[model samples]
Target: MRMCSADLNLLEKWTWNSRQNATYAGDLTSDGYMSTQQLAQAWKQKFPGLLTDNRHDYLFKFVNDQRSSTTFRAFTEGLFRAQEDTYDIAKETDEKLLRPYKFCSSWVKNVEENNDTLTQLRTFESKQEYKEMITNISLRLGFNYDIQKELVKHMYQMCRYNKAWDVSQISPWCAVFTKEDLKRLEYAEDLETYYKYGYGTPMNQQIGCTGVKDMMDFFKIHVDKDTPQQPRSSVRLATAPALLLALGALGARRDSAPLTADNYHSAVALARRWTSSTIAPFNANLAAVLYKCTPNSNLQINEQYQVLFMENEKPMNLEECRVGLCNYTFVKNRFGLIADNCNLDFCNSATKTTGLIGFTLLFVFITKLL
Candidate 1:
């Protein structure tokens, strides 16, 4: 008892409180340990996030006990160890910075392997083909048809934005794509072919959740690859400006019509030169664009929930799906693209200014700034 720390003191207090002034301390539990209800109530107060008031919550499952002294002792020890281990703020901040990478990597792998929408991307060939695929997948996955085309199309547009192409034999020259595609055509040789066909976006969605620090690291990777041609100053100077300029120079203005074959073909030609090495961050950006084309509809949703469900086995209702739509502002802020007011003006202006300066200083290294 003398060696028992503050946690033990608190545990004793909780035990006594649970007994409600009973004469004997042994009255806390018939088995001489706190009951599940007592442990749950204590955990709810101490670790509210871990244990909701629901009958079968996270902590209850974690401890795996209706009546067990082992779980109680482990829980008590964990809290004490956590408190003792987190003394340095700097260390905690470093861990916080590194945490998202682990989360993003784990999340990306899970979704790529599991999400039916993304998986369906590999087999896509034509609009009709995709519609049929979606119909089948919806039936197989227990998704209702009311949300079928909407969900499938959401993923379809993202695939296009990511530079995936229609590789089906049905229409080899078709510029327009559906949710179905055999392979992404993002790595073409000619500018016309590449712009028309290349999956110019990054290989994965890891970009959607990264920050400025991660962008800097990404630049470092390209710098190491392009050492003789790419100087550190040039890399830093060109990135932001190049993105702004490419976006500004975009020729095709968005329209209200559902994207037609003609519309897609023309848009790709107009923005052919406007390429991205890492298009993952643009997932949210593209979602924002699609939302404008059709606001307040299911088509406007981001892929976060789609990806999240791949890692988590928890079932979600349709209402929950509709309610939990990811906001454009939220996504931008998550990736350090915006500052206050959820406005892109600050970031855009800064990038444009820096891009111009960088362009002047590093003219030779100015190939594909974004």
Candidate 2:
């Protein structure tokens, strides 16, 4: 019943408009506004059992909900307005909480800006399956010539966006591609995501430990039962890249081999385990819950356990504990090193250069010094 979201304003506007425009049959008065009792009855009819029979309860809930929305809007607007008054790009970039990856020079250089990271992505686009998809879609749409990859990608995105916005209506852009073709396009995107931001690179996992460490520290305090000044639960809104890094830190949904063009057809079976559609989809969430278990006849004292859920399903199992519920001690020991230190030196150190060029540079530097 408690709602906090970035779309609060939109939701409020939609709710207000819907309520104002809705026909309430006999509930409306001559003045075109319903009494408290009439409004309650109308809400009860519309939502069925969600609203109580008492008009006072309805009014109280409405007022509190509106207050929450207003407070949230004011807080967010105030923060942004303050930022606008004294905007400094450098200062903003230096904020670790806001831009954690920007602090890691090596990650910024080797991963974020590296052209080599897109090797698999470029290869996938050049593959026969991808080219054929473009050709087939063009022919299906009555176009004389084959459409470019960018055009197809744009159409695919439009189809996805339109479908998400209104599920009741089918998008015209989606008509260009068949179900099979959509799957291929989805797979192509999966390759890009996996390589660019996922467990394909070790640096991602290393950087991800920073977030995991904070989560572990918070959970540890709860397990120990020491009263804290902070809120019981924590929520962080992060970008897709940050989400991917956190997934890497947790070591979840990783395949034995890297996703590449060679395994495009073969990796279809592995899609269930490693596909981006499931791993990093829109509004994706990863959560860990701590549960206190009562002492049974086998034990004398109460115990605390933890369960990690990805999108509401417990998908990971730790070797030290049971399938779904992991022992606190085991969870602590397993990720202790990662949680303690993310080995930030790895981010500071330059990646090793290779081949004749590297040796030539070293030789030239030594020769010049002598």
- C-alpha lDDT of all candidate models, in order: 0.27, 0.52
What TM-score does candidate 2 reach?
0.64
The residue-level lDDT of candidate 2 at 80 comes to 31
TM-scores for candidates 1 onward, in order: 0.20, 0.64
- Cα error, candidate 1, residue 320 (Å): 36
Question: Which pairs clash (backbone N, Cα, C closer than 3 Å) in model 1?
Answer: 124-180, 124-181, 125-180, 125-181, 163-199, 185-198, 186-198, 186-199, 241-355
Per-residue C-alpha lDDT of model 2 across residues 1-370, encoded as one tens digit per residue? 1122423333333321233232422122222121222322332343343232222211110011332223222222332333232222111121343235667778878877788877888888898888888888877665778888899988887676555545665666766677888878877777776766687677778787866776677667655663322333343434456666777777766776778877877744345356766655433445555555554536432344544433323335434444544555666876666788756776567663221000000000000000
| Span of ten consecutive residues with least summed lDDT in model 2 | 361-370
Question: How many collisions per candidate?
Answer: 9, 0
Top candidate when judged by lDDT against the true structure: 2
Runs in model 1 deviating more than 4 A are 1-106, 117-120, 126-184, 187-209, 213-370
Looking at model 2, residue 236 earns an lDDT score of 43
